[model samples]
Target chain A: MFTSIKRIVRSGFVGFWRNAFVSFSSIFVMTITLLVVGTVMLGNQLLGTTLEQIQNKVDINVYMVTTASQESVLRLKTSLEALPDVREVTYTSREDALAVFRDRHKNDELTIQALEELEENPLGASLAIRAKDTTHYESINAFLKEQQILEDPSAPVIDRVNFNDNKEAIDKLTAIIDTVERVTYIAMLVLVVASILITFNTIRLAIYTTREEISVMRLVGASNTFIRGPFMLQGVMYGLVSGVLTLLILYPVALWLGPATESFFLLNIFNYFVAEFGRLFAVIVGSGVVLGMISSMLAISRYLRV
Target chain B: MIYFDKVSKIYNGGQSTALEDITFQIAPNEFVSIVGHSGAGKTTLLKMLIAEDRPSGGDVFFESLNIHSIPKSRLPQYRRKIGTVFQDFKLLPHKTAYENIAFAMEANGRTDTEIAENVPQALELVDLADKIWNFPSELSGGEKQRVAIARAIVNQPDIIIADEPTGNLDPIATYEVVQILKKINDLGTTVIMTTHNKGVIDALERRVITMDEGRIIRDDAAGKYVL
Candidate 1:
């Protein structure tokens, strides 16, 4: 058994080298397929990073009445923090709000004088609320609205929630995220399926050229495994070579696009590629080998029927 | 020993019949030649013996095991007992003459040392020992046929089936191939050959089974070329 396996591998190498042109063409086609897969990986990362940056910039602010106690506000902050949908809630005391207002007006002399004329600070305490997911913001906002009423009805502690003012922008970003994700997933699926088909057909054509040889092997009393082993090994070789070639090709491309992507999308693609090199290798090279094997198996089965 | 019991073959739902109610038997170490014109079912009969084609009726037995009834998984083991040579030579173009011969042994799971020791001897039997390193394309038609014959006998099969093996060879090359087949038969391997060449059939003076259409018309011991 060991001897047979050794011979099979040796024959596989011999066949690969003997049909150098066909093997090269198969590797070339498989490399293009792997490149598509790699591009999808990078595109997904880029999209994910961009969406995360946008999500971070979105938040809802809540204003408290000037008469509201700091303790009550802190208690509300604690409750908000306890909510699963809420990622964080930051509170600015009335004094801190007044200081921020004054700092903003410090650049304009007239605005500074107007702020100082008011002896009591007109600015209210506020809490900035961020949700765990962009889609979770609506539930968080509803939860805040339910807490708008205070136990002391005479003094309304909650003055206003800024959710309505930012609703359009938040909704638009959420929709864009949903649409982009759906479109990207579908596009990636289509590309992967198409790549498999193209690679399968290319390998099929290569096998077709050697169909006569396959029959000869069958007639020579070669078992199905004996006939198929070399082709499968060739498939694996195509995948291994193409996988490495695809990665090598992507290296310079990622480097060239690194600065442009970093400036425009706020993520350096080349850095990400380097950081995820191991994972990328596993996915791309692994897929290449699997694709090659499946294609070869499918292509050679018909001839083995002899 | 081999037996063909009423082996009949019909094709395309009886649109054509390649063989009809044919039967024959031969003991071990016999050199049998099947001769006929094209469409005489000569090739089909060879195919049935090899189990490459199934007869529409009846059965063929190789030493009591029904050749057609052998399961697909065990077919390779059964085929290894017989070496087949074709008119087209059927040598793998990419393989050297040595590799072509070694391939048969390899398929049969022969040890590397055995292959290394025997491949040269098989090539030497065909008188092309020096051309072992040459690919099929690098060799002449007769040389390729000889390489194919070497491959056939390399594993030392119980029987050698040559189907119009020398159909593409010239008179000199044909004589060389006939001589090799005769030599292999002398070494006690039952050789079943099919031919259209009158010279070969008459020259052999061996058991000749003559066929016309799908039925065997004559089975002669020490038969001459009689159509």
Candidate 2:
């Protein structure tokens, strides 16, 4: 058995190297198809990273009424922090808000002059709210708005404001990313099919080239498996080599694009890409080897009953 | 020993049988010749011996193992026990003549040392030892036929089945090939050969079986070209 295996492996390698052009072309085609798939997967992951960053930064800012006491606003901030969904609540005093406004306009001469002309600080003290999940922000905002401490009975403790202004644009971005993710997955599936077809055809051609040897072997009392062994081994070798080639094409591209792609989005998802490279490599290689073996197995099994 | 017992073979959608109740038996180490016209079931009988094709009716026995009833998977082992030479002289074009003979020994699982010793002896037997490294394309018609005979007998099988062993050879080349098969037969290998040549069959003067339209018209002891 080991001798047969050795013969098959040796024959496979000899066949692979002898048909150098065909071997290179098959590997090249597999790499190109895999590259299209790997790039799209990486792109979609980056898009998810961008969307997640944007969602985390989005929040409902609650401004207290201009006449509300500092104590009332501070007490409301504490209550906001106590809520289950609330991740953070910062109490920005009126003077502290004014100071930020002045500092932001320090480089803008006209805006600084306007802020300096004000006799008293006019900015209202407010609490900034963050939630555990952005989807829960609506309920959290509603609860804060309905609070008796935030609402003034005499003057309404909080002023009117809306947090749903960016709703349409955010929804559109989410929809686009979701659609792209689905399309990318489908595109990947199609590439996989093409890769398998190409590998099958390539190995089929190899079988044709070695048909004389096959016929001779069959007649020489080599069993069916003995005659078909080298071809199957060739298929496996092609798959393994192509799989490694595909990963070779993917890893460096992932590494190079990591920072460049991060520039397009709010965060660098390349780290996630790097972390997942081992897993992705395993899957791609496993599929490549499987595709190779299956194509060989099917092709040889169909034509090589001799 | 190979025995064909009332074996009849008919192709599907055909009106006539290829072989009609052909009964024959040859003892161990016999040199036999089968002569007939084309479509005389000469090749069919040879194939049945190797279980390459089954007798449509009755059984073919190779040393008491019913070849027709043997499972397909065990057929290779049956074939390996018998050497075969075809009219085409099926030497691999890519391999040298020596490699062609060596391949037969390889298939029979002979050791490299045995192959090394036996291949040279087989090639020398056919007087093609000097042309061992030449490919089939580089060799003459007679040389290729010799290489094929060498390959057929290299594994030292119990029997050598030669279907039209000299169908393409000239008179001298045909004599040379028959002499090789005769030598192998003398070495205790049963040689079952089919041919159309009257001169070669008359010279062989061995057990002759004659067939016409699938039926063995005559079987003679120490037979000549009776047909």
Candidate 3:
């Protein structure tokens, strides 16, 4: 058994080099397939992170009336924070809001002069509310509207509750993101199918090139297992080599694009790749090997019947 | 011993019958030559012997066991008992002559030491000791055929089938190949050869089976080229 395995492995190595052109092309095609798969995965990761960042920026602001005291505002903040759907509620004092506005328009002299002309600060103290999920924002807004502080005229603690002025645009953006995610997943599925077909054809052609050799092996009293062992091993080798090649190509591209993409999307793609290196390697290499073996097995089956 | 009991082969779904009602038997260690014209089913008969093709009718028996009746899994083991040399040589282009001979032994699970010990001896038997490392592409027609013969006999099979083994060789090369086949036969290996050369057929002076249109017309002992 040990001898058989040794012969099989040696024959596989020899067969790879013997049919160098076919073997090289098989590896080349497999590498391209792996690259497509890897790129799609990375794109999905980037898209997910980008969508999360956009969702994190979204929040509802509740502006308090001028008469509302800081104690009451803090109480409101604490109550909002206690809600199950709310992630956090931050309190901004009127002075703090004014300071933020001044800092934002620091370069505009007219805005600074106008702010100074006002004898008192005009900005209202507010509670900034964030929801645990982007979909929960509507429920949290409804919960705020149902509060007694906003409805009771006697209390008159709440002034105006602003969720987002361009709610239509936000909804559209969310819809677009969902559509893109769905399309990306579909595209990945299509690519996977295409890769399998291409790899299968490539291996089939390679086996065709060795049709004569296969017949000779069969005529010489070689068993089906003996004849098949080398080809299967060759297939596995193609997958393993192509997987490593894909990673070699992917790592550099990810590294180069990391800083550049971070500046534009505010997400570090390279860090994500590095952090998930073990899983990504398994996925890429495992797919490559399995694909190679399956294609080879299917291709070689036609000739082994004799 | 090999026996063919009323064997017949029809190809293309009975559109053509390559062999019909063929019956023959050869004792162990007997050298036999099968002679026929191009479409006389010589190749078909050889294929049946190796189980490369099943007879459409009747049975081909090798030592009381029907060749076609063997299970698919046991076919390789059965084929290993018989060595075959083809007209085309059929040597693998990428393998050296040494590797080619070793390959036949390797198929039967011979050890490294066994292969190392016997490959050179097999090459020497075929007078190709010096060209052991030469690939098929790098060898001459005669040398390739010799390498092929070496590969066939390396496994020390009970019977050797030479299907027009000297078809591609010149006169001198043909003589050398015939002499090797005769020598192997003398060494207790049954050799069944098919040929068109009148000189080779006349020189053999052994049992000759002649066929015409898939039917054996004559089976003569100490036969000549009397077509």
Candidate 4:
């Protein structure tokens, strides 16, 4: 058994080197496939991070009436926090709101002068509410409306509700992100199918090149396992080599593009690749090996019947 | 012993019959030559012996074991008992003469030590010792056939089937290939050869089976080229 395994390995290596051009072509094509797969994975990750950042910037601010007590605003904050979809609720005192306004306009002379001329702080105390997810924002908004903290004069008597101002922009952004997520999924599916077909054809051509040799081997009293063992090993070698080659190509490109993309996306892609090295290795190499083996198996099955 | 018991083969579901009711027995260590023109079912008959194709009717037997009846898993074991050589020489183009013979041994689960020890002897038996490292393209037609013969006999099979091994060779090369076949036969391996050459059939002068149109026309002991 050991000898048979040894011969299989030796013949597989011999077969690979003997058909150098075909092997190289297979590895090259597989490398490109892995690169595309890796890039899409990175794109998905980037999209997730970008969407999270955008969602984090979305929130509703409820302004209190000038006559409303601070205790009532605190009670409103507690009530907002009790909602299932509401992620967090914070109350900013009028003085604190005024301080923030002053700080924000400190660098602009005209704005600072305008703020100083007002003498009294015009900003109202407010409750800022954040939702757990973009989809939950609507539920939280409904809850706020039902409470009428800002709309109904008798209910909490808040001066204004600022949620509607950014509602349109947030809804558009959510729709775009949802569409992009769906498109990315479809694109991934298409890429997987395309890569499988390409790899299949590539390995088929490689096996076709060895069709004569395979028949000759069959005629020589070689058991099916003995004959197929080498070709399967060759397929595995193609996968293994291409997997490493993809990483070789990917790492340097990721390194070079990391800082460049970081400036645009505010996320370092190289760090992500490195952080997920083990999983990426498994995915790239596993796909290559599986694809190569399947292709070769299909190719060789027709000729082995003799 | 090899026996074809009323074996028949009709290709493509009776679109054509390649062999019909062919019955013959080759004893141990016998040298048999099958003679026929092209498409005489000579190759098909040989294919049946190696279980390459099943006979449509009847059975082929190797030592009382029906060749076609053997399970597919055990077919390799059955085939390893017989070695085959082709007119094309069927030598792997990339393999050297030595590696070609070693490949056969390797297929049969021969160890590295056995392959190393036997491959050189097999090459020497075929008179290709000096060109053991030469690839098929680098060798002459005769030399390539010799390497094929070496590869066939390397594992020391019970029978050697030469299907027009000298078909691609010139007269001198043909003589050389026939002489090597005779040598292998002399060494006690049964040889079943098919050919169209009158000189080869006459020179063989052994048991000759002549075929025409998928039927055996004559079977003669010590026969010549009588068409």
C-alpha lDDT of all candidate models, in order: 0.89, 0.80, 0.88, 0.86
TM-score comparison, 1 vs 2, better candidate: 1
Predicted candidate 2, C-alpha RMSD: 4.9
Task: Evaluate every candidate with DockQ and list the scores.
Answer: 0.64, 0.37, 0.57, 0.60
Error of 4 at B226 (Å): 4.4
lDDT per residue as tens, model 2, A58-98: 77777766777898888778877888998998788888888
**What is the TM-score of each candidate's chain B when compared with the real chain B?**
0.98, 0.96, 0.98, 0.98
Best by DockQ: 1
Judged by TM-score, which candidate is best?
Answer: 1
Question: Residues A138-221, candidate 4, lDDT per residue (tens digit)?
Answer: 777777677674444665547767777778888888788788878877876787677667766766776788777777777778
True contacts kept of 4: 0.70
Could you tell me which 10 consecutive residues in candidate 1 chain B have the lowest summed lDDT? B99-108
Number of the top-ranking candidate, with lDDT as the measure? 1
**Candidate 3 residue A131 C-alpha distance from true site, Å:** 6.6
lDDT of 4 by residue, B97-205 (tens): 8888887888889899999999999988988899989888999999999999998898889999999988999999999999999999999999999998999988888
Runs off by more than 4 Å, candidate 3? A18-24, A56-171, A185-210, B64-66, B69-73, B93-95, B130-140, B221-226
> Which pairs clash inside model 3?
none
Question: Which residue pairs overlap in candidate 2's backbone?
Answer: A65-A157, A152-A156, A152-A157
